[model samples]
Target: MTAKLTDAPVRVMIVDDHEVVRRGIVTVIDASPSLSVVGEASTVDEALRRLPAVRPEVLIVDLQLPDGTGIDVMRRARELEPLQKMLVLTSFDDDSALRESRAVGASGMLLKSSRSRDIVVAIERVAEGLTVWPARAPEEDDELSATDQRIVELIGDGCTNKEIADELGIAEKTVKNRITAILHALGLQRRTQVAAREAARRRAGWK
Candidate 1:
């Protein structure tokens, strides 16, 4: 495939299954001076077929497609161009989807409800090699149960599973389960990372 001309506007591809949504995104990109919609596809197969000919600088893909999920498209697209950027457009807020998208090399997630300006900004950010997750308000940070927060706090304090269980007056196994869920929710691998993140949040006075 021919590489993008250095002087050309940032080329973007839209892969949402909905025609209206695809048009809406195209309009948004068109209005941005630095970005342009170079191609559009409604299914994973279509996206894969067209991607070789139209290798966009960034791909805005919806998670659910008629042929397969956007994750499938992302994996294939990455194989075609390892450096290609991916931005996920989805209505679902499920953590599993977020984790899977990130795992398959998506750089950002934009809700369908996001304003046009935010969508445009996301496209730019992804093109710039930045990872984009939604911003959460202090109140929104309260998604974790109070118990979960306390558990994370104890982790920050370097508590063991037995220590946390005893402190929270719960079974040790319960503490382990809660910690597992917290890691999944935070998309972290280790307890130390979770603890460090929670500590940073506390220091920053975020909720």
Candidate 2:
């Protein structure tokens, strides 16, 4: 947290309820030449219990957990180890959660859907007192707004343009144009491809 100066691999911890997700991220972190996984916890209580002993330099945390929440872990860690840095790794892009994270001393946030390289870079920057997560506050319009994500989910569920408009209480023409833009942005030629891709993301709990 104090601008890591040592060449030793930065000590990192991971906290996520899902075993698959925790292990997947551990693999990515351990693979990084400049990082190392020093500890892991699946619940807020567990994280607090281990913090004093493990003493990680940075913590890669998920927003939701079986017990309390990542905010609990971050807040408690701030008390126990003021120098420990926190990096949020979550599936939800909710603005409220982002605000809460920054208030609790999280240095940066990353989506679980981020590329391996991006995750690695985020941890590295946060460890050095640099920042990322658009490297600042959530923009009014990110690459994908919450409304656009809802539309993608509806498409994945096989909703027709008219049905999507009805569900979202918007005009059908607007739905059509949004679909066109989403497909173009994703570099897909057909709506079916969007359906297939987004469907997979939803299945993996990327809401």
Candidate 3:
């Protein structure tokens, strides 16, 4: 997902379970000239309802929520807009949590302990289709081709074959065939399983 191609401030939505957490982020965003807070949500349910309405250029989300995890929100949000830019701003730095965020199409992950300036920069970066996550390359790929790697990213972003076709400017049949081959190459039975590891050998980093 990419940010709006304009000079206007980035429209951002903050989703956190705690008001104080949200407020702290809000304060940081408010201080950045290139960012603006458009909406806020305290739970997955509320986030689902408000996210589409706000249609933010950047989404700052927490991993744990009252009703569901931020991965649930990002997954649902990606369904509505596969190009939606998202960043997981969480307190946890474990691999399972980080990989989960990557599995749902997050462009970046930032620890809550990071500096205020880092938060502002992460929002801007994700909005532009650039990653802000700590880099930890996967040990190795299962000999996935370049094209196969791209398909994995789209699948993780909740894109259908048709959608992937449109994004890659290929036929729907081609997309389907490639996905099958990709699954075989990765030794994975389901698309969801392979989505956790992605293109460019970009493994989830714990930092």
lDDT at 121, model 1: 69
| Model with the higher TM-score, candidate 1 or 2 | 1
Residue-level lDDT for 196 in candidate 2: 88
lDDT, candidate 2, equals: 0.81
lDDT of 2 by residue, 79-149 (tens): 99787789998996677887899899887788898899978877887776654544222232245557777
* TM-score of model number 1: 0.65
- CA lDDT of each candidate? 0.83, 0.81, 0.79
Give candidate 1 misplaced runs (Cα > 4 Å): 1-7, 136-207
Q: What is the lDDT of residue 12 in candidate 2?
A: 95
TM-score of each: 0.65, 0.64, 0.66
Residue pairs with colliding backbones in model 1 are none
Clashing pairs in 3: none
Range of the 10 consecutive residues with the lowest summed lDDT in candidate 2: 133-142
